[model samples]
Target chain A: MSRTAIWYWAARAAFGWLILLAAQVIWLVADTAGVPLSVHVTGLVATAVVAAAHVTVMPQWRYRVHRWEATPAAVFTQSGWFRQEWRIAPVSRIQTVDSERGPLEQLFRLANVTVTTASAAGPIKVGGLDRDTAQRLVAELTANAQATAGDAT
Target chain B: MSGPGGGPLSGPAETGWRRLSPRMLLVHPVQEVVRAAPALLGLLVAGTSSGGKGHLWSAAGVGLTVLFGMLRWFTTTYRISPEQVQVRRGLLNRKVLTVPRDRVRTVDVTSHVLHRVLGLARVEVGTGTSDRRHDSRLKLDALSADEAARLRVELLHRSPAGQFPGTQAPAGQSPTAQSPTAQSPATSPVSPAAETELARMRPGWVRFGPFTMSGLVTVGVIGGFVSRLVSEGNIDLDRVGPVRETWRWFSAMSLALEIATVLLALMVFVGVASTLGYVLAYGNFRLTRHAEGTLHVTRGLLTRRATTIEERRLRGVEIDEPLLLRAVRGARLSAVTTGLRSKEGGQRGGSTLLPPAPRTEAVAVAGLVLSHTPGATGGPSPVTGPDTGPLTSPLTSPLTVPLIPHGPAALRRRFTRAFGVHAPILLALLLLWVLGEPPLWPWLTAAALLPVTALLAADRYRSLGHALTSGYLVTRWGSLVRRRVVLRCDGVIGWTVERSFFQRRAGLATLTATTAAGAQSYQVRDVDLAEALRLAAAGTPGLLDPFLEPAGSASQ
Candidate 1:
């Protein structure tokens, strides 16, 4: 995990909150809907307060919680702040390795690596890694996966 | 009967692409007609309103349907090659689906009333993928009953020479144990190999029907229809003669009597409906071991279903005891195999090894299935010598072995969660009453749920346990549907440990064993964090070792 992940998280949070705030603003401005002014003000206040708190606290908390490590045998990752998850996928069972970078991630030079297995329980995503690190991780995982035998199922 | 390389050898006539049973032509036209009934009716109405053109249009509609049915027969062709089973279809856009012989996991043969009447059956070849997409499976609809049966046998009997030497020895030796006279005519003439009847639906098992609650679905459908009719003002119960008289008589009774009468009627209705459903679905239920290393399940009344599961694809077995069924000591057994229909899929019941029967019987069947798993590498060796004899205690097999409880921390967590959710709701209701909603009685009534919730939480804790057998990871959980899942250790593909803030504070974690079979991921909920790590480490030996942060720091 990179230190710049904090900025990336903050940016992502801000972008999401902005969209929600915009929706709230539009709702408030729509006078034809006939919602009382007090309800609109209360909703806006609540949204702003929650958004501010989330934007400030979530990034630092997530940075502290998020962890990732890849070995020849398996890929291990710990993610999420409130509901943390530790995923371990054995190298033999890994079907595919992928690296993704969103617009915000690209700006912060951060990326996420996802390793999927035959299980529909979903892929293990190690997010908020330095771009190069994510690339290297994907390459290493792909190589190890290719070396293993069997149909992975 | 097998080819040079042990695969099903296709005859000269069978090697080339062949069309489905020509008898399908009869079925397809009728099916198409039924499918287009609504459209045909609309067309008929249009033609009638506009005067005699309706007849011509209706004729054209039926003709079009028949043509489409005929076109289907012309377009579709299948081939049974030594290496693959291929189905090439589609008119404008030709498509070919090839499934390797070795990859065939299950072969399901189904026939509805119409198909049965036509002496036809549908064969669906499952290629052992968890993917639920329709095209993922190779389905040949409306094959002659005999051809379907033979194809099913051929596809699954890849290793024809391989045999289970002592697997079902008891079952094979005991001729009196089986009542082959009861087998359906469709299955009786197919294979002459030694068949071992593992389990059969006893007549007394119908008593466990109501506990299954499948009849509730029927009741819901009826309720929905009635409600729709009432809402649409199509039928007025008060005006209807018999209904009006019944309502009058019902209303004449006292409130207590009315309630009791309604409850009694509902109970009786559910029992009768569920009993009927059970009889229809599992009337001739039989789980038998075919000599060709497959477990064949033949069941159903009106729509006879015969499912063939290659024993090698079977990963484990699940012994499900729903709350109601558990009360009556009834449990259902389902095979935890890959490539079968998912739980959400309509044909999900195809995986059932045994329907709701005695808990002891369910356990015994599970043992029989597990003990005979062919080529189970690194799995626990089968318990030799008459372990299945007179299962006085249901907990004799690894499937029913005692589990390691998640401990006091998990119990506390369960209580905390239960109280945390319920007490707040009670408080909220109190607050609502205080704020002048004027519902003191409702709040008082709801307060009664607090004790029930506490009891449920305790039971949930009691149910939360996991055990690692020599070859399986057994996990038990849930309150309403307590499932004891015994997953083969070799089937486990990955491990995931989850921790919420509350769990972190309590030093607890929920560990999930991810697999491609059954429900995909079975969790050991609210175990000690250190214990969860240890379990994960042991469950898949070298997979978690590289991730562990040294020996002493694993508790962290």
Candidate 2:
């Protein structure tokens, strides 16, 4: 997996743990109001078990994250550890491409790249990259797509 | 004003020949009768129930009927001139509309069965604007067929002269003609051959038979059924039963006089309704091509409409063949043009140049109308083609290879195994349902399994083929209607590749592209990592190409 993919999962795990901790705190508060001590103990045990299960199951295949490579003829990206797969979009079929960044991405100095075609509702976004890298990638890919369109004419 | 011959030319030329359309005599009374039916019935019911105010109510009803008849008679008038056409009339507030020749788009002449018997046809001038915004510009009703034709020619001659009298240019020649090499024809009357050709192109009554009638019948039946259901709770079987009974009885009877009479009346009503629909839809249908590549179309039964489209304004063309039309080898062609708005506020009315025709005819009309070049035809063919392009490239190779410790094939096996693992859940539910003690939980769980299994199967099917070619990226993946959208590399306005939390767990990503037309954006779902980058690069080759010099690159 790419370092970015690992970071993404790590962030998810951290968020999941925060949710568990909140559940534990609510259980403790109920116990202090003299509702039930057994309830608090059961809640704590469940949270720990769930958190441990997630940590074990998620990191098993972390090596399949992919980076995109764009050429004059096509654009492609690959990801998957066990069932390796690839996607290619020829230049002629590409309708448009855009690069965007959200507030969270801005804080992390990262940007997302979105690509669109003629027949679909929403564009695909490839996120978790530095802003400059994302912009450069978008510019190059748009030029290649346009060149192919001109060739069709 | 007095003519050079010393005759007064104003005020309808003081001739009884300048009369209100005969259509007004026939239709205005019918409209009045229809509008008054409910009020008349209500008054009758009230007078019968109360037994008081009986004479007063009867007198009022007679007064209303007489008033309506007179109103219909007085509210219509039309006048024609060599230079202009004017229509003026109103019951309360007067409306006088004058349509100058320059603004008139098309003149349509049409006749109904009644009109055919009377030897009269309605001449409607469509000025390419709604009556609400523009004053009423068309003749109120039918005129003599010969007069309609004469008026059309007169308006055609007046238009160019009206706009630029000093130039003395021919009616067919425009300043913005596309071809510099082609010479314009000198001014002359519309040729006899052109008029004959138009008459030949007129849709005959025979052409409006089974298909049009069946469509009208279907709509009527469905509407009747729905309305009955809404008002009376369940459908009234009586209505359908009577229609069937009447038909059977009419056919079975060989000698019954009353049955013949009833069948004849029913047939007459059906005939009238169908003829009315045809007249309203195709009335005054006229298509004329001006010498300057502009096509004008005018049609309407009551509220006549006209449309004129310049050839240079067209952006794209769409040819549609619905299932029923396709069975009959018929097609409808329409051009998507820039800067033309349907005067109907995007609602129910617009004048189409060509009515639905045979496929070959539709194509010929399209070629004549749009002057389409060779290149615009390539996109539609590829959408239906079998050999789409290559599947992967180097940028996506790393995504296929194991980035973590386990590699990509193992992940697919895991997903496939997970799908297989869910099968027992269905069996467990079925077992509980089969037992004497019914388990509601199991049935609900099994019901949920159906969609999940279907979704997984679809995803697997989609993963089978994803590719790119030299000129375009062709992606084919849709569960309901298989769609293959080709995006030219340079055509890509913008693109995005996304992986959500669920997709991250499943090792899938989606790609989307935005194009110039705004409507033709592409969104490909659950694609492999390699395919997404290839699409992105192919969609934007200039930005993606590392070796290309900045000076040589084109700006998006």
Candidate 3:
């Protein structure tokens, strides 16, 4: 297994902008509801700065830091834009393997693979993979998990 | 099937689907009413405006609750074959849930005061899903006590691995063993040595009740209730204008007296609540080891519960000593076991093997339980005084030793973390000062807390130590509730290494051994990078060898 497609960052950036648009609308409505002009203006400005940082600067940083590896024995995921997390889920512990490509991801030809285990932290999501790669990973992981299902007990 | 309630609890000779006790239809509505009783004050305020209409809605609400209860009773039916359990529920949109026999973990029998009086109990089947969202496998609202116990034992016996299939079982025992339930129809006698009583609640333990955290919890509950009342406008000062003025006038009469009177009242209330909470939860606490490699825990007064955990599901044991309890030489013993936990979403609601007892007695019981338990081998290098009990020799148990204590670096790390938290608040205070007249009280409070924070950090650093027992890895930490866990190294599934930028700068990393047991992960926090790697490698030798070696670097 290898790294996810670079287009994943663009998909995430699209979500960031959508959230900014929602914030702007909420602030505008609040302003109409007799809210102070300064408060609304400050809120809009803060949202805009965050939106800009998220779409442009943060995505590049995220792409640099994010990583994933699917070995025969385990799947390792390095995620998070700021507080990075490195998670390792042994194939023996995997309960289910699923991949999804939503409306936003279809534009970028990317999909996310979720590997769930009965562990406390729940699932490990490997996002931004090319749709075909994600589907292949899911298949490979499912087979590997099935092989080791009863080996531990 | 619509027979009298006093028939054979097998339920009127049902053919395929078995309905719950007809008495169950009343249980849900009663529970709903009790839960909704708190919200009645808000309804009262609404009643003033709506008049009889509000009462009509309340009646409708009761009617709807009863309807739902009746529908639930009518629609819900279950079939338990030897291989699996199947249940179908939902009136309009029907649904079925199938839980395989091997997947069934715990079948707990619980009966509250109401259920006890009505000769009904609740049986919940849990698949060891500690994650709260998808936790309950099946919950039968009401059943006869005898049936509940039989069902629990039978369900547990069928799933021989005990909790779940994929977890470890006892030594040399396969998942499909002799059916204990069917074999022992008469509650057959067993060898005296095979069954040992681990811990039984003494009236003496109740002396430590008022010192526990129950008082604080009760205060919080009462505070929440009062705040809810105020928020709902039911206790608005404006509505009780003269009463409010009278309270003010009374307070003005003598401020210190007023405070003293309120404090005395609160103390009495909290004291009574704490004692009552202790009695209700831990009154008849008993931990006994059964013949068939199972530990049975029976406790509670107003609500009775009997939980049986397979020795195989147990990874190890945890001994927790809260500050107040520690000061009083008391401790609580819980298990670091897999699938023994139910996601009841309570802080204090797990397999608490030993309620707050004398430290020496708790240690003796812990020694006995661990020695009998499969994973835990011998009590770790005596943390308490030797027990001179005539019944059993506690000091003779093999003690775990060579507890590795962190060096000076850990102290520095803790102090840094504590000061890092304090710096921001101080900066905010400084900014507030610059904006206007400084808040003298806030600054003074911060100044007072500074020493306390430092002391707590030092204590936490003191608590940072790790030990490798014979079969389990013993890690001790935490300040408020000092938890020393003995986890079976063999049960560890994987390792998680975490290094934040700060930790990396400090040449430290946190190594967590992920297991299915206990909290699913036991962490060695803020240890040196090399030490963390060494521990991971030592805990599971060749598993972490790739990550520790340089070739793994190339792969990453």
The digit string of per-residue lDDT tens for model 3 on B352-443 reads: 77887787787777776666444221111222222223114422332234457777777799999999999788778877877888766787
CA shift at B442, candidate 2, in angstroms?
Answer: 26
Report the Cα interface RMSD of each model, rounded to 1 decimal. 3.2, 9.3, 6.6
lDDT of candidate 2 over B1-556, digit per residue (tens)? 1111122212343341255544445655555665575565556556765787755886688667756765755775656553456776777877767775545555555555556555556666765332454355475456655555445554544333334344333333222322332212222134422211121134554243333343456457657666744444333545688867977876776666766786776566555665565566557666655543345566666644445444323333344444445556654445443223332412223435455456566555544443321122112222212111121232222112112212353246435654666767766767778885676776787767776766755543543334454344445443323333334433444455566655557656666654432134456666654555555655454434552232143212
What's the distance in Å from true for residue B463, model 2? Answer: 24
TM-score of 1: 0.81
Pairs with steric clashes in candidate 3: B381-B400
User: Which structure is stronger by lDDT: 1 or 2?
Assistant: 1
What's the CA error at residue A34 for candidate 1, in Å?
A: 13
lDDT of 2 at B519: 35
Over the stretch B1-556, how does candidate 1's per-residue lDDT look in tens digits?
2211222236343556778888777888888998887667667766776776987999999999998988898898887766678889989999999887767778889998888888888998887676656775799986878777767766665334223343323122112221222122223233455587889889999999988888888889789767754654334577889998898999999999999999999888888898888888998999998765578999988888998876656778888899999999999999887777448322457789999999989988888887756533222222222223322244545676788999888999899889999888889889999999876977897798889999999999999988776557788998998989888777888898899999989888999998887778888899988889888777676567666764367644
**Model 2 lDDT per residue over A104-139, tens place:** 556556677766554343334465667778888888
Instruction: Please give the distance, in angstroms, between residue B227's alpha carbon in candidate 1 and its true position after superposition.
Output: 6.0
* lDDT agreement with native, every candidate: 0.78, 0.50, 0.68
